[model samples]
Target: MARIAVIGAGMGAMAGAARLAVAGHRVVVYERTQTYGGAVRGFERDGFRFDTGPGLLPLPAVWRDLFLKTGREPLESHVEAVQVDPSARHVFADGTEAALPNASRAGVVAALDTALGAGAGQRWGDFLVRARESWDRTRRPLLEEPLWPNWRVLAEREPYPAVPHKRLLRTRRAGTLAEIGAWELRDPRLAALLESHALAYGLDPRTTPASAAVLPYMEHAFGTWYVRGGMRELARAVYERCLARGVEFRFGTEVTAVVEKDGRAAGVELAGGEAAEADFVVAGVAPDVLDRVAGGLAERAAGEVPARRSAASRLTVLLALRGARPEGTAHRTVVHAPDRDAELASVFDGAPGPSARPTVTVLRPDDPALVPDAGHEAVVLSATVPAALGAAADPGSRSGDPAAGAEELITAATRAIPGLRDRLLWHEVRTPADIEAATGAAGGAVPAPALAAAGGRLLHPANGTRTPGLFTVGGWSHPGGGLPHAGMSGALVAGLIVEGPEFRGSQ
Candidate 1:
C-alpha cells in the first residue's frame, strides 16, 4: 500500500486521507492552520459562535458516503440536517420578493409565477428539465472520476444523435447563466435570478458559465439543509472519523513544498524545514499555492489551470446580535443588487468604493444551543470584492476604526437589516486579505472558477494529465469546488492512486 501525504486539513484533505487509510495505505494530513476545516471552521468571540464559511449544507449523502467508507456512521455522532422551507428569500431590484422553497420544483415555479408572470412557472420548469439533464449527463462522468480519458470515452459513447458532436461542442464553450436565461426563458428578471445563484460561488452571474444553472436544480432535488448545531459540526465529524480510521493529522504545520524525485511526487517539506516522505500526495490547498509548491509544474500545465477564469474573492462581515430575530426573513436571505454587472465591475476594478452595496445573507442558528439564548443572533454579510482592495486595506484595523474598510462594510450590512446596528453586541469583518493571510488561499479566493473555464472535456479528472504517484483534489482540481464536490474529488483521487496508472490508460 502507498504511504500517502495529504496537504491541508480541509474537507478535501480529510476525505482523501480517510479513503487512503481505509484502503490500508498509511496517510498523514498536514494543515497550515490550527483548525481542521479550512473555510468551514467556526470560532467563538463573546458567547456567540459563527461558521466562518459555507452557510448551507446540501447533499448529506456525500458526507454519509465519506464516513461510511471510512467505517464510521455519520448520523450517530453529528446532527441530521433540518431541511428548511422557503429555502431562501431573494429580494429583487423592483422591491419584489420571492421565496425558493426547499426541494420543491413546483413550489419554486409557483413562487416565480406569482412574482414574475403566469408563464414564468412553465419557463422555470423547462429550465429545470434542462438542468436535470445536464446534471445527469455530467455528474458521474465529470464529478466521480479523476480527470482522465474515461470521461471522453463515455461521452463519445453516449453522444446525442441529433447533434453529431454534442459532447465535443458542449466542452468547447462555457454557457453563462445570462445566456441560458436569455436563450431559454426570455425573462431578464428570471435570468438575473438564475445568475444571482452564482453568488454561492462568489462569482458574478454574467461571467459565470451557464452550466452553473445546474446549481438550483441540484438544490431543489437534494434540498437545502442546516445541521443541528452548525455547519462546522460537519467538519468536526469528518475530522473525528479520519482520526478513527488511523489518519494522522499535523495541524498548524504549513507545507512549503511538494518534494519530487524523477519527475514524480515523493512527499512534502514543511515550513520549518522538516520533510516527510510519502508514495502519493493530494494537495487540498489553492491551485496557485499548489503551483508554487510543485515548482514549475503548474506553469508547464498552464492550459490545465483554465486561464482567465479565476473565481471572485469575498468581503465578509460577521455580526453577533442581541434581541428578537428579524421578521420577514428566512433562515437565509439574499438582498439582491439592482445591477449585478455594475456591482461586479466595481469589484473587478479594484476600487475602494462599495460594490453593489453588498448582498446580505442573514443566518440565525435554529438551535438555541448554538448561542447563549433564543434572542441571540448571528449574521454574515458577504459580497464579491476585488482581491487587490483587501490587500490595500490596513490589516490591524478594528471594528469602527476609520481605516478599516471592513468596518464600513459592516455598517452597510446593518443598514440593509433594520435595527441591526443597534442590536449588535460584537462584530468582526474579514476582508479577502484577511482570508488570504489566515488561510494562505491564493488571492483570498474561495473556489469560484468560471464555469466556462471548467466546461471542456479536459475538465473531468479521468480525462486530465497526471504525474505518477501524484494526485490533486479539491476546488483546484477537476470538477471544481463546493464542499461535497471537493470531498468526492478526494475519494476519486484515492481510487486512482490505488488502482494504478494502467487503470487510467483504459479510458
Candidate 2:
C-alpha cells in the first residue's frame, strides 16, 4: 500500500483520504487549524448557532454517496436531510414576489406565471429545456471525468444550445448570460432572477458564458436540502467518516512546502521542520497557496491563473432576532436590488462607489437547532462583494458598525423580514477577511464552478498535475467550486490515483 499525504482537512481532501484509506493506503491529513471543515465552519454564541459557510446544500447525492461508500450508515441516518419546500422566495425591485418550488419545474413555472404574468413561466420553462441540454452535454466531460489533456476543446466549445434570434433579418445566438436574459427571457424580473444565480457564485453574469444556465437547472432538478443542524454538520460527518477509515489527522499543523524526490512528490514539509514522507500527495488548497507551497508548480501545471474578478468574496450578516421564526415563511428569500445594472457595475465593473442597494439572500431555517429558544430566530443575510478590498484585509476588522455592503444586505433583507431592524438582538458581520482566515483563499475569493465559455475564465485547473505523484482536489481543481463540485473533485482525484494515468473517467 502506498503512503499518501493529504494537505488541508477540507471536505474534499478528507473525502479523498477516506477513499484512499479504504483502498489500503496509510493516509495522514495535515490541517493548519484545529478544525477540519475548512470554510464549512460554524459560529455560536449564547446558545445560538449559525453556519458561517453555505446555508443550503445543493446536489446532496454527492455526500450521500460518500457516506454510503465509506460506512454502512446512510447519510440520512447521520444527519437529517430535510427537503426545503418552496426552495426560495424572490422579492424583485418592483415589489413583485415569486416562491419557486423545490425540484419542480412545473411548479416553478406556475409560480412565476402567477407572479410575473402569463408567459413568464413558459419562457423560463423553455430556457430550462436548453439548460438541460447543456447539463447533459457537459456533465460527463466536466464532472464525471478528469479534465482531458485536450481541455481547450471544452473551453472553445459552448455546450448550451442558444436559440438563434432573428433581428432585422440577422440571426445570432446568445453568448453571455446577460444576453440570454435580455433577449431570451425578455423580462426585467426574469433577467434579475437569472443573473442572481451567477452572482451568488461570485460570477459576473455579463461576462459568464450562457452555459451558466445549468446553475439554476441543477438546483431545480436536484432540489435544495438542509441538514438538521447546519452545513457545518455535513463537514463534521465527512471528517468522522475519514477517522473511521483509519485516517490520521494532525491539527494545528501547517504544511510549508511540497518535498520532491527525483522529480516526484516525496512528501510534505511542515512549519516546524518536520517532514512526513509519502508515496503520493494530495493538496486541497486554493490555487495561490498551492503555487506558494509547490514553488510555482500551480502555474506550470495549470497554465495562466485567471485574474481575480471583482465580484468574488461574500459578505454575510448573522442576525440573532428577538422574535420567533414565523410559520409558513419560506426558508430562503432573495431581495433583488432596485438597480441591478448599478449594482452589477459596482460589483463587477469596480465602479467608483458602491451601489445604493445590493441583492441579498436571507436564510431563516426553521430547524430548532439553530436558535436559543422558540422565542428567537437565527437569520443569515449574504451578498456578493468585490474581492481584494483593502479594508476587508485588515486583521483587526470588527462587526460593530456594518460596512456599506453589509448595510445594503441588512436593508435588502428587511424586504423579506418585516421589522428586521427591531427584531435583531445582535448581529455579526463575516467579511472576506474572515473567509480568508478560514479557507486560505486570496482575498477570501470564493471559486465559481467550472464553465465552458468566457475564454476559459470559469474553468479550473486539471486534477492531475505536471508533477508526478502530485494532485490537487477541491474547489481549486477540476470541476471548480460549490459543495458538489468539490466533492466530485475528490472522486476524480481518487480515481486517477488508483487507476493510473490511463483512467479516463469515473465509471
Candidate 3:
C-alpha cells in the first residue's frame, strides 16, 4: 500500500483521505487549523448556530457516494438531510414573489406563472430544457471524471443551446448569460430570476457563458438540501468517517513546504521543520497557495489549465432575533437588488467597495437547534462582494464598511423577514478576510464552479500537476467550487491515485 500525505482537513481532502485509507493506503491528513472543514465552518452562541460557509448542499449524491465508497453505512445514517420544499422563495425588485417547489419542474412553472405572468413559467421551463442539455453534455467530464487532457474542447464548445434570435435583421444566438436572460426569458423579473443562480456563485452573469444555465438546472433536478444542525455537521461526519477508516489527522500542525525527493513529491515539511515521507501527496488548497508549496512555482504539466484569480467573496451577516420563525417560511429567500446593473458592476467590474444595494440571500431554516429557544430565531444574510473592500468610488454610496453591506442586507431582508431590525437582537458580520484566515485562499476569493464556455476562464487547473506523485483536490482545482464539487474533487484525486491515469470516471 502506498503511503499518502494529504494537506488540509477540508471536505475534499478528507474525502480523498478516507477513500485512500479504504484502498489500504496509509493516509495522514495535516491541517494548519485546529479543526477540519476548511470554509465549511460554523458559529455558535447561546444555542444559535450558523454556517459560516455554504448554507446548503446541492447534488448530495457526491457526498453520498463518498460515504458509500468508504463504509457500509449510507450518508443518511450519519446526518439527516432535509430537502427544503418550495426550494426557494424569490422576492423580485418589483416586489413580486415566487416560491419554487423542490425538484418539481411543473410546480416551479406553475408558481412562476402565478407570480410573473401567463407565459413566464413556460419560458423558464423551456430554458431549463436547454440547461439540462448543458448538464448532460458536461456532467461526466466536469464532475464525474478527471479534467480531460483536451480541456480546450470544453472551453471552445458551448453546451447550452441558445435559441436563435433575430436582431437588426440578422440571426444571432445568445452567448453570455445576460443575452440568455434578455433574448430568451424576455421579462425583466424573469431575467433577474435566471441571473440569480449565477450571482449566487459569485459569477457575473453579464459576462458568464450561457452554459451556466446548467447551474439552475442542477439545483432544480437534484434539489437543495440542508443538513441538520448546520452544514458543519456534515463536515464533522466526513472527518469522523476518515478517522473510522484509520486515516490519521494532525490538526494545528501547519505544512510549511512540500518535500521533494528525486524530482517527485515524496512528502511534506511541517512548520517546526518535521518531514513525513509518503508515496503520494494530495494538496487541498487554492492554486496560489499551492505555488508556495515547493518554495517556488510548483511544476505544471504541459497544456494544464492555468489557475484563475477571482475577486469575488461573500459578506455574511448572522442575525440573532427575538421572535419565533413563522410557520411555512421558505428555508431560503433571495431578495433581488433594486439596481442590478450597479450591483453587478460593483461586485464584478467596478471599484473595490461594498455594493450600494446588493442582492441579498436570506436563510431562515426552521430548525430548533439554531435558536436559543422557541422565542428566538437565527437568520443568515449573505451577499456577493469584492474581495477587497474599500471606500465607495461613488462618494454618496455606502461602500467602505462591511457594516454598510450588512445594513444593505438587512434592508433587503426586511422584505423577507417582517420587522427585521426590530427583531434583531444581535448580529455578527463575516468578511472575506475571515475566509482568507480560514482557508488560505488569497483575498478570501471564493472559486466558482467550472463552466463549459467563456473561453474556459471559468475552468480550474487540472488536479494532476507536472510533479510526479502529487495531485490536487478542492474548490480551486478541477470541477471548481461548492460543496458538491469539492466532494467530487476528492473522489477524482483518489481515483487518479488508486487507478492510475487510465481511470476514466466512477461507474
> Which is the leading candidate under lDDT?
3
- TM-score for all models, in order of appearance: 0.86, 0.96, 0.97
Give the per-residue lDDT digits (tens) of candidate 3, residues 1-507.
999999999888998899999999999999988999999999998789999999999999999999999987899999999998879999999999999999999999999999998999999999999999999999999998899998999999999999999999999999988999999999989899889999988899989999999899999999999998999999999999999999999999988899888988899999989999999999998766788876443655567788877778888999999989999999999999998998988887765645558888999998998887999999999988776542233121237566676778888899898888888889988877788778988767888998887888999988887888888899989889999999999999999999999988787
- lDDT of each residue in 1-507, candidate 1, tens digit only: 778988888777788788888999999998877878877867677777777778788777778788777785665455667887778877666767777888988888899899888998778877887778767765665566555443334423321111112343463222566666666677867776777677757666665555666677678799988887788888888888889889999888888988888978899899989999998877777766777787554332533434222446666667788886655557876766666666666655444444445555656556665677778877776666555443444332212122354564565555346787788887777766766765567557666521323335324232123466667677666666677777777777777777765443112
The alpha-carbon deviation from the true structure for residue 119 of candidate 3, after best TM-score superposition, in angstroms, is: 0.2
- The full ranking of all candidates by TM-score, starting with the best, is 3, 2, 1
TM-score comparison, 2 vs 3, better candidate: 3
Error of 1 at 498 (Å): 1.5
Write down the lDDT of every candidate, Cα atoms only: 0.67, 0.85, 0.88
TM-score-superior candidate, 1 or 3 = 3
Residue pairs in candidate 3 whose N, alpha carbon or C atoms collide under 3 angstroms: none
Highest TM-score: which candidate?
A: 3
The TM-score, computed over Cα atoms with residue i paired to residue i, of candidate 2 is 0.96
Clashing pairs in 2: none
Candidate 2, residues 180-235: lDDT per residue as tens digits?
Answer: 99889999999999999999998888889999999999999999999989999999
